[model samples]
Target: MQIDSTNICERLCNKSIRDISWLLNIPRSTVSGIITKWKQLGTTATQSPSGRPRHMTERGQRMLKRTVRRSRQLSAESIAKDLQTPCGLQNSTTTVRRELHGMGSHGREAASKLYITKCNALDAMV
Candidate 1:
């Protein structure tokens, strides 16, 4: 259900905040804020939330995509090094991982290097 303030305001003249909220299916707090702003500025809030600020530009993202597409098996560190060397965008390994993940690329799995050293000398005491 879409709420159109213009239509609702036209339908209900001199409606209270609660009335407006109930009719429009919006939060009463939001309606109150709107009414307060309307009283002071004669308009409602219009600001929209922009997504997280981009650390890299569109050109940089394109370059990164190209680099990853060229070498599917490139390590995160290697990719970061390449980016820093050619473009001087020296981002950390974590940042590179995030960028690749954002671009719909799969993260390379790290090979497990677990090792065990038996302590036979310590067992001799038992």
Candidate 2:
């Protein structure tokens, strides 16, 4: 169980914010802020941060994965083109490449295999 500064301040009873800061080895501003928050909001928990939303949704990601799996040879431009209609959104080739990279697909072509039978080797030697 971790004890927070709010609990420490509450336990101090009539102790000054500076006293709490000195005894707890915390900054006076931090001690004062915690006490102020407890008095105002009745809790010392931090609020969640608001940030920008994603450009692509979960469905868009799934569609991209399915398209890549269907044709490993497709370039990022072609994949982005295909995604536009089905996913109902437009993404740049760079974005598609980035998404593919994030999904652990390097978008590389399959390696070609060379066949060399015994007869072929003998013919090459001649």
Candidate 3:
């Protein structure tokens, strides 16, 4: 359930955290946290999470896509090795495989050719 900030402000602006908690049916700590966040940020919206950045940039992803499109049969290890060039990303085979899977291009074994019949050579001769 989404909380309407304006509704909460208008209803509980002058109220205690206990009152707000009782009125909203949420925990006192939650109400207090929300009030603290609003006071500091002037908004109740959640901020983007802080964490490690992605290894691949947009340019890197585009380059990877082009490389994959150019040769779908390339192994992930080969791709990783190619990516070690100055113009490409230096990544592990696992990273290449993960990126490929993320892009919806799964690795597949090449299918074998079907056995040829006598008529196949006859048709070719014709």
State which candidate has the highest lDDT.
2
Each model's lDDT comes to 0.74, 0.79, 0.77
lDDT of 1 by residue, 9-115 (tens): 73358677677777678787766766666667765656667889778777778888999999889898988889998888968878888888988898757799745
Model 3, position 81: C-alpha lDDT score: 80
lDDT of 2 by residue, 104-124 (tens): 999566799879999999999
Lowest lDDT 10-residue stretch of candidate 2: 1-10
Ranking by TM-score: 3, 1, 2
User: TM-scores of the models, in the given order?
Assistant: 0.57, 0.55, 0.58
Please identify model 2 stretches exceeding 4 Å from their true place.
Answer: 1-39, 42-51, 111-126
Q: Which stretches of candidate 3 lie above 4 Å from their native place?
A: 1-29, 41-51, 110-126
Question: How many clashes does each candidate structure show, in the order listed?
Answer: 0, 0, 0
| Pairs in clash, predicted candidate 2 | none
Task: Count backbone clashes in candidate 3.
Answer: 0
Predicted structure 2: lDDT: 0.79
lDDT, residue 10, model 1: 33
Model 3, position 23: C-alpha lDDT score = 75
